[model samples]
Target chain A: MINYWIAGIYPRNAKLIESTRLYDKTLKEQFKKEKSRLLKIQSDNKLDFISDPLIDWDDNLRPFTNSLRGIERGPLTRYYENNTFYRQPIIKSKIGTSGNILKNSICFDLFNKKSKVKIDILDPFTFYDLSANEFYKSEEEAVNAFAGIIKKELISIKNNVKLIQFNAPSLARVVERDRLNMVKKAIENIVRGIDTKTCLNLWGSDISNTFEEFQEFPTDIIGIDFTSTRVDRFDKIKMKKGLACGLIDAKNTKMEKSADVIRELRNIKNVFNPESISITSSWDFEFIPESFADRKLQIMKQIKEKSKMMKL
Target chain B: MKKFPLATQEIGSIRKPRWLVKLLQDKNVSDEVKEEARSDVALLNLKLFEDIGLDVIYDGEARRVEMYEYSIRRIEGLQLAGKIRSWDNKYYNKGRCTKKVKYTGPYHVDEFLFVKENANRMIKLPITGAYTLADWSYNEAYKSKEDFTIDLARKVIRPLIKDLVKTGADFIQIDEPAATTHPDEMQLVVDSFNESIKGINAKFGIHICYSEDYSNMYPEVLEMKNHQYELEFANRDSWNKGINHSNRNGYESFLKTFREYGEKKEIGLGVLDVHVDEIESPELVRDRILYAVKMTDNPNLVHVNPDCGLRTRSRETSFAKLKNMVIGTEMAKKKLQL
Candidate 1:
């Protein structure tokens, strides 16, 4: 039986706020109550990774300070207001490298009673890519350490989770054709013993170089980004593993039609009928509005209906 | 004489005038402080241009931060996280920054606005492309860099470009120095540029530098289907005695691919090297421009500019380089008169 999967861009402030309100009651109580009701609607939709209802106190939410030795003062919060000389900090916590606030936000969503969908964590590679390296000596060391920590945490939460896909968006940055071999090797090392089924989310731009550089790996599935890279290039790549075709554009707020999505899938089906082909979002939909999330779910449902008709 | 507009890639020395440094520090300082800062750099930039005898000018990006640092401040929903060390020993922040669909402030345009108002000549507004912004930023918030880039193009950058075009700007240059980092990301960069320039009727130019590897250039050229053969012999395998076959192979098909990009936009061909401190002779610059002109069918669209910004070089070295470049352009224009 073909298993259908739905993926959207990772949740941002709106999703975080909703998840936080459900977990916290002190926000005027009314906003929290309203957020709970909204989350219930999301729960009824069978969305993946319910907003975690429990708030973790271990997460750090304080403004970044330069008290840490050897670390430069990160960009001021108002730096984004105009052109300035500050670099923003990569806030990570014991739970994750993205800092306490994001980790708590993700955790809050993960344990949210209303969320019934499978949970996928943003991969450690992307986090390490965003991390300030005054602490670590090299990218490999940072990634390995971060992955180890994530693996330990996943062990505790693996039972309730349906699937834990790792987002490796930074994989696109390795441009040296030969460096991809090292990347694949690194990925293999990080994911070697994890129990949960993992998917390596790769951007379309990375696929051309990746195919030329690292041909095959032991991962269960490979997520292809269709929105960023041209769909035509997929015809040239040869994959031995299952293909997670990202047919939906997760960045733009413009809603795509179910027919258009099915058309994109049909094009992929013609190229390679893998062991299993799952349709997903090209990237995270959080950059867009909350309504776009609803549109994404609707698109997933349409894909499911169309996939059922195809009987692949 | 060939009309080569004056431009500088990243230069090294940042010895700011004491008064200007003090003015940047004072928040309550009057418009006079800001104007003085703008004028001081404008005078320096204009002096460099005058000495070089070039038509177009820039204030050398003196009053701003690095491209990524400047943009990071304007994007909302992201916080200052921590720092990452670059290969050059500089520490950069590691945060979930996005060029995605939000605008906290005007960003580089505001900086350019000051430059344009202060400059005596038709100023060139340089903004980092969404692709570079997305490529360099942490993609944790979004699904992929492309997704983040497209969102950035559609939401933050496109709107900003439209606003920039409305500002009566003559030329808008999108700097894609990171184009060589990930060649596959070139299409997204192109798309973002196309989207950003959709409604604007301004003269658009792209500045790419330090892409000696040639691997990044091939994919982009092939994708765009442009035929321009302005190859840099210094970066060839012969330069290193034993040809690094991989680097050699990467550039083998570059000539055919470059032709494709040359067809669309005015190629601001980087005939002058930005990384090296050794000053190139005007004759060599003329030869490079002439070679580029011969390679592309439409030599008229070619504009001689630096390979990248001159912010990384010292004031004297950068001025000398610009002077040579202007002289070369003048000679090339004379030799290849339409």
Candidate 2:
């Protein structure tokens, strides 16, 4: 069971960050900084799993922004929460990767081998949806191209990674049935040749509508955000594989008590039993302050310890 | 009948001069050095507005960074939480409220006072709206998003408006680019917008854009005490491949919404596109304004401005755009015989 790993970017420790290097740092330096920060956070909390920290691609197009050339920066638009804004990458030319995207970041050692270091990639659907496609004829074409590109990257680094999580909030956001299938096909295309344990983390919309399809998804694990979706709906869907229960609230700063989290996980256990269960945040930890984020992780660790004693 | 037919206004935030941006970026500079640099450019920004013959002008938000973050740092009880991704890979330094938000005096008053003292023409104050600040921020103190927004409006925003109005601000424009981002939350925006302007003695207006559905805010938007609706149109214009050449007609969809719901209110028609580098000709601006006048069936109800703020554009482009807007409005005034 992989319990209590963080998903998405960890908030930066403000005391350690230099504002001048925000956009000036080289890719190698950024990776070193991220690993160091994650290691510090892990040691501080005594966490089991190594997290990628998502600090590497804080302001660049993740999983695809290999270089700064051939991409135009779109105007800053409001994120769903309205507090943060991302400048979307406009694909001005053919999208391709020149090298291994996650080589420098992932650490392989005795402690890291004992527990997998989690790395996140923007799912093909979201990459296509957020992009201004000037080259592709339609969004479907763009998705297909992106899937092939992502599949190549995944296969190249399949051994180095312990878990490959696809950030697919777009799949949950799609309303039309046909569009949903296209996104699913795109996901299927991206994960075709990968042997790493795969997890599809869906949020920002209800999962009940596509619960049956998600259960049959060709991946090792499935993550459902309990913050945005109702837990009662999960009773009807049976999990045949690993389940990543997003128990931590990502959007708000308020932390849930360990007892409350344990109770919720116990209730989830009463439903369809899976091969394994993992605990994580509902979404990105970047939404909250760093101190609060550390507290949230500590609460998750507490839940992990309490769950062990309870023996669900 | 109206104070000025085809009134020319420059939306808040002309681009920062390169030297000014450099001065702000340098850490070695003392506080006095940066303040001097800011004050000089602010006066220059105001002088540019006067030179271009703008009817209503602002100091271009010279003292601020962006719309939301600058005002947020000044308010009481809110703290910089962490950076969060808005989309793709772009991130912003976001904030969270630790306690009940309070008006910690005025943030933009000094900037406004400088503009008010210098500007020879009518000046309008542009402030980030309550709903936008609430919607963009992390809500920790309130149980519901609506509750947080309402408290922000009543406590932080209303008092700011009251202060600005008390300081002889005749016109106040609240910029809410995040207004219609969520269709369901438009009610929160409308209700809180009304709450923000309550008991304020000034001619109020709202700026909403980059949203597809302005209609959702309407009927409820009509309920607000504001007088003008400044919306982006030139950015959405479809190009017409005419017999001779091509031209941009941004107001094609502009009239469709205004005709249905904007019968009683004034419209600040955006005739220039700030997202692009192509300077709009006076003829194109005149054509867009004419289209608005024809479609809305009221020439007096239309005021001319850019689609959005010029913060993204170069100073040269912004100045030329504003100059063309004034000239185009003059042409429209002559043509309409208003």
Candidate 3:
């Protein structure tokens, strides 16, 4: 059986975006109004595992930069091939994440008592790769320090969410064999005692053929960004666990055809019998305008409904 | 100041006056009335630049709205789609190239001529390039990027450059922030740039804001049809206002390459960081210019400018930054005995 869910930060509606620019204090009522609108959309789709759309986040790294004790936002680094930019996290001193950074960023008021959620954060290796490390003596130490914060944060929210997604965009590249082991070890330490389902999401480049490297990661799911990986070569690829099929195009404004999305789902179902499958985006929805992103979400709903009827 | 080695100049745009912005946005205002207001502001802006002692100047771009949208609205076969995010809170209306793009100039001619009418210094007119327009737009009309860029270079932008030359525009700068965005598109940029200036007889420059990687543009960038390469440096450098080696570290990475080209290509060195409202001190600007002059090994080729644009800053901040830039350049000139 499979489910549909959205991952990462979402775009602010036009009115909210306008208000954010002018208002020093966030319009809480209006903010909640827009967030509830997003929540209603997800609830209408009948998915147990849900996301908040993370409207408060400027980028995936922003909220954490403020929460963490030793890091600050640096220059505008280009976010992959897209025209958008994200502030680089500069790890100035030894990192200490005291509070629940992820939990603070999430809007729980919009969710009902029964609503389960999915939490997204950068994995240890990916966080290090994205950051400008000034204090860490070695890559191993930095990865471990980051893994410590992830463990602490996950412990706080493990009861509320259905799954924990560790976004590792750096793994989308051709990593050295030794570095892959380091990421695997880091994830192992981060999720050592946590019983919640955890997935490692990778994107920004094609690592389809290199799926062999991820075989040892101690994760419940291995998410692949299908937009970067060739879908035609799905026959040759193999998967051991759940596959979060990132079919939605994050960069392009053109909406995806539901039939095309279903065809790829069918292709994956035939090739590998994974434990679970989820429909998601290749990257954050922040790249697209709010108007288009909302329309795309509706199209994704259609794809999920059609796939279920066809017994995907 | 007779032979200013590090000649100060304006890059991109200055902050638009609040009154000008309000007048333009007011729906009840007539187009004719808005035009009159903009021209009046342009003259005031020109005087502002002159007061700051900029050797080369423009009208601070008060007459146009944004660099892209202003041109996109006038050109044929392009429709202005609503706002698209350039950065946080800053939106530019990104248009889609729905058909073959055509040049319906004098898009920038009136804007440039008005500044020329008011300016008392050498004018280096900044116009958006063909490759940038092609790259930035949604390419639904053209067969491929190459085709769209070539048509843009040859058909659209080339005609405008020819017109600018005829109108006594001395130095024409083609602003291509998207030049090295995609490394594979480097040669195409070179080809399209040469096509834009194929037979035009005028001094030209290329502006690339915070290039992803300058190494990729390489020898390919040198082949382009331009005289100056105006790029960002101060954004990446240290904020420390000192003449020490580490203070000017950001510009160190590209100096050897600029030195290799030597006086054959001029370096429009950006000494002020426009993103920050904190005005750079004269000492900081002097150190940056001094460092580049020594590193590039040719004082004659370096021209001082802001890293990108001061348009993002407030009017007061832009004025202070420019004022300090001129003061800093003079201080460096005095030290160099030029």
Candidate 4:
């Protein structure tokens, strides 16, 4: 059988929205109470990966709420006040604990033994680039600390998960040739410590050199960002395993047709034949509106059908 | 008498000469229009600078459409596909493939010659940095931005800087606004700066703005694991609408990170925010300068400037902003006893 895999870019909107609300509260007591509720929901649902809900919802409240004061020429204030902006006090308690939240929610229903879909969890890079703090003198030290946390987290989920991909989008921006070498070293250090099946996610307008730098790493899968870079360039790079073909355009609001997507996929097939192939986007689907996201999902479903029919 | 007098000259636009244009064009243009509209306009720009009594005068980049665009025009094997519509609705031409071309004319030498000949003042040679050129273009030929940027630095930008030195240009400004946008890529930016000035005899400077999310400039700072300041500094009240949270109060952090770059080179700190139309006061400018000085600890190395290119603002706002910047620099000098 031609092995085919489909992975949704991790950190869905519902979880992200819930996490943002939990991060808004000042009181630790309220935060704990909300955390339990959100965790309970996630536990019931069974999410593969989750993050510490750290986005401040209150920070977004002004721009969102002020836009509702009849001064703007857009949507109604009541819809924004009630629906668009989520600021419930109970929700504020469970922020950043999305993995537990997903484990406790109705999503767990989708994780039964009979489920054919394998879940992949994506973790954001802990300390690739950051400012030196009072607690940490250098970013390398901070990254090492984060790597320890990531190691613990990955060990906990390795039993059930199929893949644990680390999103190191920061690596793409390294301008210096030597610094690019350093970024690769950091990625290798983090990945070597993880005791699970893992992949590296890369994004940027330019990826030609990034792929070459990362070729030295021990990742099982190599994800290419076709959103910005051309597909023809992928043929030049030598790869060993699966190619996470980002065929979908995530940045634009307009949905892409399956025919156009299939054309791009067919072009990839001509070059490197891997053990398995999967379809994905260059970045998160949630960056766009919900309606656009729905259409994108629908398009992916259609692409899956076409992939089966045109089995290589 | 003005001590250490600075001179200025206008580099002619980077366009094909009239004879070349005449040979290539399908339709012919009148000789008078080519000489008057194109050549005289370039000459007039240089003359205007000479009249202003400025030490270093330039043709204000009259020959080129955009700095990045002009650089790409020299490189071959790139297809001008379509335009990428920016968030602000401006469209920039996107390149599809990477092809190599012969380096025929000197990138900035023609402009240098024009300035040297016409202007009595010392000329300032401005060239787009390798990082900016690589960041702005579509990298169809190279594997990554870093590789393309390094290649540009080694093959094109470095050699061009050397040529400027040979021609006796006094000062060279490597314009690098993209440096702030990708801080993780700062090593590449720094490498390019080093490559450009390597074995150069002239004074070198880097111009950067502060309006965008400068957190990326110090990837080490952004990767700080703790959320202690995230709660206090990243709150809603602290946020300004339409501005990235990292841009809200990142200047202090930006300065701290910039200290790594302070060992050598004078940094043109964009004290005034160019995006907003509001005119900043000398007091505010002084505060900005003082902050930079404290972080850098070298008053001689800090130069007051507007965030980026002033083309975006109105003439009135631009003038007011520059005047305020001069005042702010003076105030900072007084406060710091420099």
Candidate 5:
């Protein structure tokens, strides 16, 4: 039977917003309060395994650019897409990570208590491609520079981390095979000698365009956005690493039927029955309202039960 | 007899009054009562425009909720299914089309007619463009984004434009803020726009602003049926303090595009910045307009306006900005000796 771990990229849903109770408190206070509440909710859910709650009450609005703003040399702008705006980190100078990059952002309150926790970070290529490169000479150099900085940060926290998923939607956008090679090099640099299981989550575009390049990634697990990408063609490819099949549409409020989700999972299991398989939303639940996200998770739990009954 | 050297107008929408906003927010107010209040507010906005002495004016969109939602709510074959983030801490109640899009009725016609009857001057009707209406919403039922966008143009936008034209609206501005979001699909945008305004007989224009990928806008955009391009240049004037376009990096590229291809089209130069709270000095607005005139190389084709809508700011800010815009246009007219 498949392990059937349920996970998500980020947990900043609308329900979290309504329940967080942020009135007059500073962003720091809100972050801590929201973090505690998120951990409690996740603990209550009692899933098999979980990822970081991304209790970014402080940095959720600007996530990547907020990290850069703390540093001396980060120029940022609004990233407009999907009815949401993220701060596009504009590289105005040599990129460097401040010690306070993810300090107050991460919630370790539920650490080592109930389930193994995963931390998600922006992939080196995504970090490079999404930004305005003023300092770096070339795209490759900027990616590598970003990779080196991220590598140092990961190496320090690799012991406690069960898995480190790199959000690499930018890789999916690349049409050229040569640029994919540069992304591969950058990924290899970031994960060099790390013990933690590395997962690469790609969304916002079809992954099949860069499937050949994705196969070359050094990560231990790969996530496919089955909602957006035609996972029907995926059976032909002989897969090796664990696969996280995104069966839920994160952007839509309507919940997928549990049986339909299970059927999709079964198709993926038949194709690349690798080390294990996990079910997840196509992207961040933040794209959806809280009630819908909660309903979607409920459907995921139902799908897990159905999958177990099928004994695939 | 002529007002100023170049025509001065608002892109669309003025700042909504706070008391009216409070009344709208009150759930106890009946829909009938709320609509009556909104009509009163619309009349107030129309009077305000005439008082400001704008060459072309709108009802400030006082009766509608922003641009996109108002249309979505009225259009058939659409449903508000989810909430999506528009920007930092701001989310729009978004929807999608599950069936073939059809015309529900004339959503903007009543609003347009009300303004037309009230305004003493020429009034332009601003409708959310087909591309933006489709682009901003999720595509649930459409076979392809291109097909869906075309459907929107033919079924939704074209009818609205025709109705507005039939109602004697002299100018109709299609707001396509999402046009350049996907640079690859700009061809689709242009094609769909042509389809929307296909048989509509009115002076049509396109309004685009705050798009991050404005640089990716291909020269082919000017090929649309629009006679004028109303864009926001003042919003991009963040780094500069004195309101001069010399410091704006965007101004140079925009100038190059207009000078190369804007000979046939009128350029509504946004001389006053709307994003900032600081009211621009008339001299600054004059300088920005003068700079835009010099860059475009066709002062006759250039017009003066604010960068974008003033709906987000206070009512006083909106009026003051328009006042400064008028004063500055007069200053530029003197300098140009027209």
Candidate 6:
């Protein structure tokens, strides 16, 4: 089986852009309308799972930052290598979840109540690494506490959510190989009792050497950026879990050919046979413009249709 | 050159007057109305900075919409895709260069000449730097980052700068907020900045704002062709009143690192935290200044200013910050009895 969905905040259209800037009464109206429009766009294109554009989120870290008990929104920090910026989550005291962490994140009022929803959260290690840890005593303890926080967050949203995606752009930046096991343990802790499917998406770094370590992880799907990591990097590893191949470059305005994407995916499927194959974006479409992001979605749909013809 | 021990200058921008902002944003307003409004605001801003006892000031960049768009819109061969958020809901119109970009005209020259005509104090022309232009834009045409930045310097920025210098604009402040964005590309910044002022005989200083650690630029930044480097320090430091190493901890890396290089370049020490409206007391600003001076062992090498542009703050708040900055510098000077 093959699945398709997006991972991060989609680029805002003209209406959403204006409404967000104004931040008036029209903000909620525009947001609800925009969410429906995005879900419809994906539904019409035949994506296996659908999600809100995350228009309400300032970034992926907002939900946790806003809902967590002991975290404060700190000064603006660069979001990875991109031009985008986000407030660093400052840990002030012992971590605790106060309310529904997904209250602001997932909106059921816009959904059909039957949509296979996909939610993206910063992976525990990446969250721990990106955060300013003033309270935690050790790296292991902080990461475990973060994992517990994510587990609690997932447990609340598990009943309706179809896929819980953990985006780990900083996962491959772990220099010490021993930390890889720690990350694996964190991943296991999040999805331990949750019945829904999950994807552990890793990108922005070539995890060629650590490919073997991820093959045994608890995630049902392990996503990799084919651009950052050469397709042949995982040629030897016969993955136990399914694979999500990030074929589209999200940062640039340039369009990718669907035929080229299918050809690459075909080669990827031939060697490292997994339970299934899924196509995704390299990271967020937030870096690109709205018009270009829509065009990229069209290209993603074409790749899905063409993959059916190959029957690989 | 060091006659003024602690000179003060507005970094780049001041908040546009409310009525002027409205006039500029109005689609029905005539260009004559828009131009007159900007000129009036510019005149008032010059008086405000001067009234605060600033030794050097500009027209507060009232004529241009911003540091980036005003320059980016004037360049040819680059098409603006759409608005993208930098922080909060603040948007910058991102552009893509499909071919070699050239300056459409010297838009800043007229603005510079106008400021010189109005302000009695020493003035600076704050233009966007080449590395920042290349870093902020999507460079599809240029072969490499170096090629893109160099082209922007030699083709776009240098020509406009030559025209400004001809208009009696001797003190040029090149605003490069994205200079140390990529720590590895510090050489590219030096190369492009050096290329921009190759033959021009003007006092060029680089103004770097909020970004990654400026410490990354050091060792490499020393090679850049410029006399002074103005940077933001108040954002990281506290507002407490003390000249000790602990109170002025924000400038610790800067003081320690620059001392290694012998503190040759004049350092623009930021005293006011522009992000907040709470003004730093004169004593606090004095401490921030005294600490930098004590570490450098030369009060002449230090210049005091706000952290970055005051474009986001209200006009009243911006004026207050500058006034306190002047008072604080005076306090520092009195203690030294210079």
Instruction: Give all candidates' CA lDDT scores.
Output: 0.54, 0.75, 0.81, 0.50, 0.73, 0.83
Docking class of 2: acceptable
State the lDDT of candidate 1 residue by residue for A185-277, as single tens digits: 666765667656667777534475454343365567777777765667656444577777777766544467877877777777677566667
Q: Give the clashing pairs for model 2.
A: A82-B136, A83-B136, B237-B250
In terms of DockQ, which candidate is stronger, 1 or 4? Answer: 4
Q: After TM-score superposition, what is the CA distance of residue B197 in candidate 6 from its true location, in Å?
A: 1.9
Report the lDDT of model 3 for residue A183: 75
What tens digits encode model 3's per-residue C-alpha lDDT throughout B1-338? 13335777898687778888898899999999999998888898889899889999998888778788887888898776555556666656667778998888778889888888888998999998888887777676887889999998899899998998888887888888888788878999899989999998888888887676666687777778788889888888898866556777788768866666544677899888888888899988988988888887667778999988789899899999999999999998898888
The better candidate by lDDT, 2 or 3, is 3
**Candidate 5 deviant stretches above 4 angstroms:** A1-48, A55-64, A67-80, A110-112, A155-157, A176-178, A232-235, A269-273, B1-5, B30-33, B219-222, B241-246, B281-284
DockQ of 6: 0.54
Judging by TM-score against the true structure, name the best candidate.
Answer: 6
Give the CA lDDT, 0 to 100, for residue A180 in model 4: 57
- Chain B TM for prediction 2: 0.93
| Residue-by-residue lDDT tens digits, candidate 2, A196-220 | 7888888666787786777767778
lDDT of 6 by residue, A31-129 (tens): 888889989998888788887788778877878887788899886677876667787898999888843787556776677766788888888999988
Per-candidate clashes come to 65, 3, 0, 60, 2, 0
Best by DockQ: 6
Give the distance in Å from residue B132's predicted Cα in candidate 2 to where it truly belongs.
Answer: 1.4
Clashes of 5: 2
Per-model chain A TM:
0.70, 0.88, 0.94, 0.63, 0.87, 0.96
Please state the error at residue A172 of candidate 3 in Å. 1.4
Clashing pairs in 3: none
For model 4, residues A1-312, the per-residue Cα lDDT tens digits are 232332332222343344443453554444344434433333333322322221112221222222211112211111110111122111111112212322332133334353332333333232324211234455455445444444544554555555655655555555566665554565566566555566666654567655666665567766666776676665543467666666666544446788888888777755646545666666654234434544666677666677668873
Which parts of model 1 have CA positions greater than 4 angstroms off?
A: A1-312, B1-35, B91-95, B98-100, B108-114, B212-255, B260-264
Q: What are the root-mean-square deviations of the candidates from the true structure over C-alphas?
A: 13.5, 4.5, 2.5, 15.5, 3.7, 2.2
DockQ of 2: 0.32
